[model samples]
Target: MKNGIEIMNVEQTFNGKKVLNGINVKIEKGEIFGLLGPSGAGKTTLIKILTGQLKQTEGKAEILGKDARKLTGEDYKKIGIMMDNFGLYERLSCFDNLKLFAKIYEITDDEISGILKEVGLLEAKKALAMNLSKGMRNRLQLARVLMLKPNILFLDEPTSGLDPATVDAIHGLIENERQKGTTIFLTTHNMAEAEKLCDNVALLNEGKIVEYGNPKELCRKYNHQKKIKLHLYDGQNIELEHDKSVAKILNRYFEQGLVETIHSTEPDLELVFMELTGRKLDK
Candidate 1:
């Protein structure tokens, strides 16, 4: 609440239909919080409400101790948002596109160059936005936002439709921001991304949060099977409950050099989401 984001019983309606329902969450300072759900799950709508783009139909939302609905221009300056590539100027070079925002934020040329390098876009700084690849365009957009050096960053599906390598690069950049103490609010259906990047996540479904907690802890909490799966050198596999009864068998296999690998049957975020919502996180 002091230096982070808080939403209390927030709800939203479009026309006569409700989109968000009784959503509540608290994100700590310098934490990466993920709002995860499939398409049409109101992830974007919740972001809009928090960012002051759209007011919630009911309840309160606050960022950095100020009411979201009353956030001023100065308050906005402390926030960076990269929701889409629509902010890019197709005719302008990447450098020029960033320069436009630089002027508005009073950022120096050296800082702009530094950000370009940081986002791995320095070499393509002079390339037109329209001519850049999708990945490069995404980086440029991220650069524009990072130039502000905002305390809070809102990234909605930052790596959607990107290749694995590019997604990794983007993830690295997000981690870099996290190291600098930026509070990141990310909305993605990618459960792997959430597990990799978030300190905590809220699983949203049908405009409501069905689950919320640390990603790894949530997975462990729902590990109903609690089995230890083992693969043997002889191409045989075995699963045993994580109980004292199986401890002797596990040790015997190890002593006999038959175990090749072992893993706990911990459910991942996708599986947990499915179990709770009866729907896949991707769909």
Candidate 2:
């Protein structure tokens, strides 16, 4: 079966300084594949290589089985890209900004309207892009890209600055795309979002893929010191390790009906990433 996007030992360099080092990844058809990393992790460089904006210095990058370098302008009809600070005409209304893109891509108004509704921008269509809130601008950008139902979507930090509600709305739109069989390559530092949305992920460090697997699997693999914390009704708190259940003490509390609350602490994607990279995503 064709991997929607594939890279084999890919490398990128700028001014003789390498940015990506021997990267290898295969994003399956119709799956949301996350590239997780912190700033300066070469995530953007890899995206540029995949989208054919920049050529790799070594190895191969392909979309739909064709070399990235060989992709013609026509090939872009199958791709949608939403990078950070994606431009919108500040002077134009939200609808007008999308209209410009529609005219270039030859997208009909019906599709544009439908996408605006999908991204929850239908009500703000007449508002100037500059007048729209941050969340609204994000929706408008997503709508513009969705005007063409591309087979592959490259989203870079799709929810970086938005509030929780907007983040949820954006992810809902992403899920709809995933359901429609769009292969999404998402690059984000939001580890929780990655774990929640990705079918599989590659944790990228400075230039290399430090880990690759389902997010849950990676987290489980590194959950060596799993712990549980509980507060006792008797005004005492205790921490118990998974491997060493600490049952003798816990059983005493259990028998005495003295447990007030208990919480199990499983390793999350952020902790797992930190374990591999020696730093958190924000840092």
Candidate 3:
């Protein structure tokens, strides 16, 4: 039992149009792996194949050491999914909605309350799902999945269209899940979120993986300029190559107390993605 996900040359097509092409990756147990790409980039298609919702046109996908195509009801019990179409009973109160899943999962009301509180929804427990704000609805959906305590979690665009505070709250919940040793497979087009949450990420574009690696390492690998960006006390900005030849000039600025701030010219995840695919992550 590998206790993680493995995909070997996985490919999917619809009407002879390839949506995923020769995709290959391995996700270790308790790892947070991100599939990042723009719309129509096959991220959702790959997730569906991994979760057994859809069969691949070729190759293999194994989840929790079992073939994805042969996942059983018990296998599904060990998986938690939160996606846009994960419906909520609009007529039901938040507490009731959780209660429904709790019953299915054989959990107690106490557990439901605890998770609700953890997601900052305890005060809105009795509020109808239809009346809750988008953030609250998102939290409730998260609580629903977290309460399952599944070994694997699939989150598709979990923070899309969310406010900063709400996104932060969701990120906190996700971090807590990571601490619990849950293997998370996240699909998102948000580069910043992927950089913050993913231990390793695959940059998908036009049905192929353009790049894959630790987000920070990928950024550093693409940092070609090797320069230092500096701000001076007189509001002057300078970009200088990070070489011994510039050491004297840098020391002079510091000696004169003229340096305000300095930063390395390492590219961020978005920049790295762009440099690799010649396209923006959001586009």
Candidate 4:
């Protein structure tokens, strides 16, 4: 579990106001690490510092074993970024826009075609950027990021404001990249999305990490009730608390072979977060 990204007591300030407060995190190589928080939780600011787009006022950030503040142009080539507003030439056709980025990266036409096909945008390659649907536009942005075959990807709310199907499509693409061994740094308030894509997650609140771990582990950690609902094959159900008495009853039921389904009353990520942070999701 080598460290791919590390933030060591990182702090940031803007206009004399503190934005991040002693944040510490470590993401292993080839892991989909999620920074989950509501808007204004300093997730984006931290990401910018990690990407070398902004320098932190205090502390350090390390990416791929290189100090983020000292990252060179070649290091930038190994990482791709898709922020809330990934650039695209609205007046240009999809192909032309890709051509411009390809030229910047010194990629060939054949490579561009391959990227287009990978993102399912080959048929609409010649379509004007303004003419493509929102989903198509997202795919086009993804295609541009793929030109460098980036080893690490930073995605900020990649599926925000899209329809369900489009979100699923984008998630599928992201999963494909992860399968190919790309380390992903994801910032989003979508808990469900984090649970689906992340191998580990950090709960950011008011510029601090209140919790961090694998999603299921965090959820289980805060499951204080310790109750389970058993649905019997005969259509009867029983609720049992966690204690020696209930354990004996559960074992008896199992011995009688009446159990069909067992539902544990485990708190979900949201509940765990709310319990920890004393807050809920944004709106």
Pick by TM-score: 2 or 3, better one: 3
lDDT of 4 by residue, 1-283 (tens): 3338989999998898888999998888789999988889898999899999899999999997888999898888888888877668989998898999789889999999998888888889999998988788888888888678888899888887889988998999899999989899998888899999999999999888999999989888988999989999999988899777987888899999999998888888788789988898563
- Score each candidate by Cα lDDT: 0.94, 0.88, 0.92, 0.88
TM-score of 4: 0.90
lDDT of 1: 0.94
Clashes of each: 0, 0, 0, 0
- Tell me model 2's lDDT, rounded to 2 decimals: 0.88
Writing each residue's lDDT as its tens digit, candidate 2 over 1-283 gives 2649999999988899888999999898999999999999999889988988888999999897889888887788888888875688999997788888889888888777788889888888899988988888888888877777888999988898899999999999999999899999999999999999999999998899999999988888897767878998778888887665577877887898989999777688889888887899876
Model 4: runs farther than 4 Å from truth? 1-3, 231-237, 244-261
Off by over 4 Å in 2: 1-3, 231-236, 243-262
| Winner of 1 and 3 under lDDT | 1
* Regions of candidate 1 where Cα sits further than 4 Å from its true position: none
Deviation in Å, model 4, residue 22 alpha carbon: 0.5
> What TM-score does model 3 achieve against the real structure?
0.97
Worst 10 residues of 4 by lDDT: 1-10
- Best-to-worst ranking by TM-score: 1, 3, 2, 4
Best by lDDT: 1
lDDT of 3 by residue, 1-283 (tens): 3888999999999999998999999999999999999999998888889889999999999999999999998998889888888789999999999999889879999999999999999999999999998889889998998998989999989998899999999999999999999999999999899999999999999999999999999988999999999999899999999898888988988999999999999998888888888999899
State how far residue 7 of model 4 sits from its true place (Å): 0.7
Colliding pairs, model 2? none
Model 2, poorest ten-residue lDDT window? 241-250
